[model samples]
Target: MSPPHAVIAGAGIGGLCSALCLARAGWRVSLYEKAKILEESGAGLQLSPNACAVLRKLGVLERLTPFALAPQAIRIRRARDGATLALMPLNDAEARWGAPYLVVHRADLQRALLDAVAHEGRISLQTDAAVTGFAYGSDGVAVAISRGASRLEATGDCLIGADGLRSFVRQKLSPDDLNFSGRTAWRAVVEADRVPAAMRSEETTLWLGRKAHLVHYPLRQGTIINVVAIVDEDFQPDTDNFWSSHGASKFLEARFSRWDKSARDLLSAAPEWRKWPLADRAPAARLVSGRVALLGDAAHPMLPFLAQGAAQAIEDAGVLAEVLARGQDVEASFRAYQEIRLPRVTRVQKESRRQAVIYHLGGPAAFLRDAAMRALGGETMLARYDWLYRVRESPGQK
Candidate 1:
């Protein structure tokens, strides 16, 4: 008998990861991307322990380590005075969580995934191929794809929507309005030489402030520092606006004018910036319908506060691959995939939204938050992620 086949839409972190995971599980995969060329436009992303374990299992982690930085810790500070509130040590994360916490440029990780996908004989990736819609009955699922002026259709046992926030595949499956949280994230990468040694250390530093927060971490093996400042303001997006849209420095300068000198200095050092409106969606009633299922951002678009957007997406890919490779009926496998993923991703989405508010608290609230952090200390705080960091590396694992 021929092996089961899967058709995937989108080629971002989630899509590419899905293809690699499925192929490793002994399934032939047809991955499609709407973009003629694949390029990750964002800055740095955190690869938590859970995500790292999955990547390691898929044989993609080693390719990423050269470009990935294992930060020693995450230092949380008060934006007004730059006072240390807590220090979460990550130096021993691999020992505690079973995998290392890594920070790397988004493009580097994407390239690694693409490289792995290219080498897989069971996987075929096609760019300039957009999945417009899909239909599923008893004869598996057929995807309608658009390629420039031509159209084509492909059949597979299942369809995985790994497209990003504004996914066409998602619109056809579980449609929900994207909530713009009256927040914007301005991101930039400053050369290591341009940043002061204190600001460019081997730790991820976070500054909490009034209606805003700043996070910076070293990337590219310490040659550059990725900085992101998220502020409270709703920048209504238009048709032309992308996730990483061109941003003006003046806006960031004015909003962060009253922050501590260290925060201002880091912002000034960035030669240019790109901003993205923070958007998320409520968990859908069902992530799977028939032979189709959603993965990554398409399934659960969460805020970046918890730094689990990519991690959760990676987790989704792992679980989806595991369930589908079980040799069950195609529709049952997709339903099983949803059953395993929806709850965990929903929790991360809610927690991420809560953290956003806590990071931008004002006057009295900010003080109490800091005091609590200091009292809690670093190790105590780190203990909270135990549930998140310890995950199943394979279908048979505990």
Candidate 2:
């Protein structure tokens, strides 16, 4: 008998990782993307041990290590005064979580997943093939792909929407829309040499300020530093695109005007910057419908405060493959997938938003946040996330 087939939309980390896991599980897979060509762009992302375990299981960790950096610690500070609030030791995070926490360039992770997918005989990947919709029946699913003016379709046992925040598959599954959060972020990467000595440490640092926060970490083997500065503000898009490069340097400079000099220097060093208005949806009561299911940003988009956006998606991929490889009824497998994922991602989503509020606290609240951090201690703060990092398995997974 032939192996079951799985069709996946979106070639981002979530989609690619899911494709790799499923192909390894003896499923014939087809991966689709809307981009014309895969390029090394976008800011860095942190891979806590939870996601690292999945990558190691998928056998891509070795390939990724060359392009990734393992931070020694996570440092939290007051952005205005530059005073230390807490210092969380991460060197021992591996021993605790069973895998090391890694910070990697988004492009590097994508490249690693793409390379692994290429070697797998069970997976076929296509570029510029946008997933328009899918129709499911008793036997399987027929997924529609729009390539330029041509429309093509492929059949599979089930469809997985690893597509991002604006998922076409998600719209078909539910009539919900992603609501924009009243905040904007500036993401940029600069060479290590261009950054100040204080900012070049191999530790991820979070600088908390009034109504804003700054996060920076070493990437690409410490040759580059990824900086993300977010502030509470309103954005009115004149165009349909939620992301655009039309930000003024002066505006960014003014927003962080009261931050520490080191951070401001780093911001000035970034020759170019792009602005993204954060958007998320309230956790859906259902993430699966019959033979279809949503994964990653499509299922639960959250603020970047917790840095588990990609990690949760990678986790989804692993659990999805483990459940479906059982060869149970396809619809039941999808339902099982959602049942295991919804609660976990929902908690992360809520925590991420809560952290955003804490990070952007003002005046007396900001002072209290710092005092509380100092009292809680960095180790304790780090330990608090044990639920997120120390994960061996989810429901229905061995």
lDDT top scorer:
1
Q: What's each prediction's TM-score?
A: 0.97, 0.97
Give per-residue CA lDDT, model 2, range 1-398, as digits (tens): 98888999998888999999999889999999999997644679899999999999888998999989999999998888788999999998778988999999988888899889989999999999999978998888999999999999999989999888888899888878677788888888898999878889999999999888889999987888998888898777533676655567899899989888888899999878877888878887888988998999888888888998889999999989988988799888888888888888999999999998889999898888889999999889988989889958554543
Off by over 4 Å in 2: 394-398
- Give Cα-based local distance difference scores for all models: 0.89, 0.88
Cα error of candidate 1 at position 88, Å: 0.4
User: What lDDT score is found at residue 261 in candidate 2?
Assistant: 89
Q: Which residues of candidate 1, in runs, are more than 4 Å off?
A: 239-242, 393-398
- Where is the poorest 10-residue window by lDDT in model 2? 237-246
